[model samples]
Target: MKRYLMTPGPTPIPPEVSLALAKPIIHHRTDEFKKLFDETIKLLKSVMQTKNDVVIFSSSGSGAMEAAVSNLIGESQKAITINAGKFGERWTKLVKAFGGVPVELKYEYGDYAKAEDIQKAIEKNPDIKAVYIQASETSTATAHPIDEIGLMLKEKYPEIVFVVDGITAYGAIDVKTDRWNIDIGITGSQKALMLPPGLSIISISQKAKTIIKQNSNKYFYFDILGEIGAYGKFTPPVGLIFGLKESVSIILNEGLGNVFKRHSLLAKATREAAKAIGLKLLSKRPVDSLTAIVMPDGINSSDVIKQMKELGVEVSNGQGHLKGKIIRIAHLGYFFKPDIIVGISALEIALKQLGVEFNFGEATTKAMEIFSDE
Candidate 1:
């Protein structure tokens, strides 16, 4: 059986990117490499929708998140972290690891953060230095009110830097980094950039740059100040940079608006398909990137995942406390109508094998109907 990948990150890659990566590597010190690197960064800015100086690190998305936290928050300085899911929980951990005081606003697994809550936290902690959040919480399929929170800080707390982890949001969802006043926007190539892991990208506003300069943060590999325009400050991932150019060009050629619409339609199909199977959704404010489906009572999500994998459809089980409780399916990156159909079909088969009670055929049919109508 041909396998289908339905996880949020490490999504399927298109033929163009595959072909780009197949090319032979080049030395990073030469002018030829410089031209490629510069163009790729320019295109990346388009995808990120920001004019801020963007930098790339040869590390996972977590590296960029750590860079954002370590560069801005100093010892004993307060920062507000929004904890709505596993990824949200990571922000608090990163802040604490860097010796920064984390003022975390915890929410229920499926719930989202309110901007007013962040405002209240900042108001209470007048010495807060920055606000950290996720544009899309991958763990629970939730999208926080990024725009509202960014705007609130822009108007009321201009001095506070706004850092957003857009790992699952950048290429998949329509996140306006600059327009929303995001000082630092971070993402990984694997998530929505249609590439494999190992490269992380971050965009920094001038305000963020100034703040980082004043801080005496202890870091070497992820030096944000040293990386500003050094063109890979360290040896970059040359092959992935080539792939980045192709992947970003693909997103731009499709027109950013069309990409956003396609993700929206595919996500709608997935959500409705899950409901047709008598399963509930996990997020209150779901993002178009992926959908997390609630497993039926007495049914282990791991069983469902295993059955789906046997049928050549690979998805993800929930993380943290929600593990074995919910199944996550992706519609981001290279997915289309038929991909969603196959995913839902495999899910139905898996649930049937597990003896879970649900209307089996409706899920696949619902996905088909939505795609056919579109």
Candidate 2:
């Protein structure tokens, strides 16, 4: 059986990156490591479309989310939070956990948060210090209109920092941090970055750096400012640092425009293929990172996942309330057209094996059409 990983992340790591990681580990405080570390940060900023400092952490994406709260906002500070997916819900939790007042702007699952809602929240709560959002809500498969929201925020409430959880959408979509006026943009290596789960990346604007000064939350390990100050002297995870360097090198070599275009083409192919197979898309404003398809009536998404696994393909099941209702197929990082073809073909066969009335060749044919057009 041919194997494939369609999970959102730790998406397949490129063999080249894996080989780099296998090198003998070196002390991070060494001058050689510092050079590589500095270069890695510069490359991260280039890919993230920001001139701000991009800080790296030896933690998951959640760590960056928490750091955004602890390092930026003070106790009892009010912030507008957009809750449309599991990741959005995480923003709410992180705010509350950090002793901030969370003014949640909720939306039903499977829908994007409206910019107008964000505006109203800011207008209603003039005391709001910041606006927290997920660039892509991976749980519900929705991509929030962050650019629109950012425009409104900058125009209306420039004081409110716009913190985005871009763990899934960072390299997968067009996240122009400087253009969109994003204050603090956070991502993880496991997602679109195509590395393992050990690294979290954060870009902090000069405005955000000011917020950090008054945050009052005492943090050490996740202290981004402290890390940046000591970058040339301190030790980081050397192996992961090398892995990140190699991964970012590959992405840069491919060119950002071409990388995004490839993801877009793969995403379109996946969505069109799903529709041709009579599957419903989960998110209204779907992100290019992954495609979530609603299972047919009486067919549990778990069953679909099980069948797909039997056929040597691995995709993610929905999270939280969406569990057992939708299956998420990712096309991010270390993936290309052939992988997309193989994955869709496996899904079609698996659905048939599970007694779902899907036309066997329809998805593959539609995907081919998409591939040709692209």
Candidate 3:
């Protein structure tokens, strides 16, 4: 049976990146490798759309998230954390772990965060030093208004540091890191970068750098400044670096604007297809990275997932308390229009086999109509 991977992170790797990873590994410290590494960093900044200093880490996206928390929020400091979904909840935990107090502004799983709410929270707690949030919440397949929130902070709370975990947003969506005034923007290799899960990239503003220099934080491997001056504080993942170079090249070659359009098209087709089949979407403001569909009454999402896997198509179930309540299908990196067709076809078959009543033939047809129209 032919297999398809449709998970949010660890999305299918592009052939160019796979080939680059297979090339002979080089020593990380050599001048030859430094040239490639430096080029990779430059390419990363171009894709991230930021003029601030970008740092690459030899860890998953969460590692960069940790760095943002550790460096910016010192002990006894108050920070505002927006918890709209699973990834948002992580921000609150990270703040507490770093010895900072989190004044959490939480919304329902499918709801989006508003900039006005953040303003009110900061006004209530004038001592708040930082604001932490996600650009797109993966678990809920929802998008927060990062641009509005960032601009709000820049205009009013200029002293408050703004950090955004753009793990599922960077390459998939036009995040506009610099224009958005995001002090720390984070993303992983596995998401929109079309590579394996090993590298995490972050962009830091000068204001954030100054804050880090003054703060006395106790962290070793995740030291953002240490990674900046030196190519890497320790031995970098040379193989992944090579793969990242090729992946970023692919993105830049296709052009970032075109890539974002492609993702938007795919996401629209998926959401429209699901709606055509009488399924409700979980997210009120859905992102282009993935789509979360609410399971019908008396139907278990896990059973549908199992049936799809049996047919060689692997999608994901919802995370945390949402498990067995929703099915998530990824439309991020390395995926095209035809991939969406296959995924939707398999979903129709799975729902049919389980005796869930819906217009089976209409889903793919509607998706095709949208693709053609767009």
Candidate 4:
């Protein structure tokens, strides 16, 4: 049976990217490769909406997240982390692992962070050097108000570096990196970029660049400055980078505004379908990248996930404490109207098979209606 991947990361890849990945290997040291690499980075900046310097690493998205911490926050230095979901929780862990004090502001899952809360936290912790947040918390399918928070930081705390993990937000959602004053923005190849895992990206602003210049953090592989100085600083994921160039081109050609609208429609379709089927949404501030629907009491989300997979469609179960409680359906990358319809159709069937009481075709019908209206 053919499978449809509707996960948060490792999203479906477009055929153009697949073909680019299958091309014959080329030597990385050659000038031809250098030109291709430079061209790719330039196109990537367009997607990211920034003039800041960007570096790509061969590791996963977590690698870039590590770099943001290791290179800027020195040992015993303090950084504020907003923990709203599983991904936001990573910021605290990363800061601690690098011997930095994590002044954490924890929020309930499915909720978002507010700029005022961040302001209060910074006021309490006067020595904070940086702030870490996720533009879209994948675990809960929620989007924080990064624009407001970034602007607040720039106006109030100009010296504090601002870091954002935009793994699921960069390509699917509209995140203005330069206008938002994000010092370090991180993303991965798999999420909205529509490629296989292996490439991690980070954008650096001049403010963060200065901190890296004077920091003496004990890290080698994730050296941000070293990467900026050296194209990759080591062997890069050549084929993945090739695929990235093609994938980013596809996104740019489509136009970022249109791309974001497509994602917004798909997400609305998914969210409305879930509600039409008598399910509640998980996120208070939902993102266009994905939608999380709360499972009815006594209905295990894993069971719904398994049933969907049996019908040749794959979705994700919630993480951490939310596991078995909510189902996450993705419409981020390489997804169109038909994809959303089929995913909702499979979900409708899965819920029926699980003996949940609801209108059998309501979800699919609602999704189709949403697409037609769009």
- Local distance difference test, each candidate: 0.93, 0.88, 0.93, 0.93
| Worst 10 contiguous positions by lDDT, candidate 1 | 225-234
- What is the RMSD, in Å, between candidate 1 and the native fold over all Cα? 0.8
Q: Mind giving the per-residue lDDT tens digits that candidate 3 earns over 1-374?
A: 88899989889998889999999988877889989988988999999999899999889999999999998888999999999988999999999999999999999999999999999999999999999999999999999999999999999999999999999998999899999999999999999999999998889999999999998889999999888948745989999999999999999999999999999999999999999989999999999999999989999999999999999999999999999999999999899999999999999999999999887779999899998887
Lowest summed lDDT window (length 10), candidate 3: 225-234
lDDT of 1 by residue, 1-374 (tens): 69799998889999999999999989998999989988999999999999989999999999999999988888989999999999989999999999999999999998999989999998899999999999999999999999999999999999999999999999989899999999999999998899999999999999999988888988888888788778755889899999999999999999999999999999999999999878999999999999999999999999999999999999999999989999999988998888988899999999999887777699999988998897
Residue pairs with backbone atoms closer than 3 Å in model 1 (clashes): none
Provide the clash count, candidate 3: 0
Residue pairs of candidate 4 with colliding backbone atoms: none
Give the TM-score comparing model 2 with the true structure, all chains together.
0.97
Candidate 2 per-residue lDDT, tens place, 224-282, comes to 78866466444566888888889988989999999889989999999999999899998
- State residue 84's C-alpha deviation in candidate 3, in Å: 0.8
| Model 3 whole-model lDDT (C-alpha atoms) | 0.93
For each candidate, how many residue pairs have backbone atoms clashing (under 3 Å)?
0, 0, 0, 0
Q: Where does candidate 1 stray beyond 4 Å?
A: none
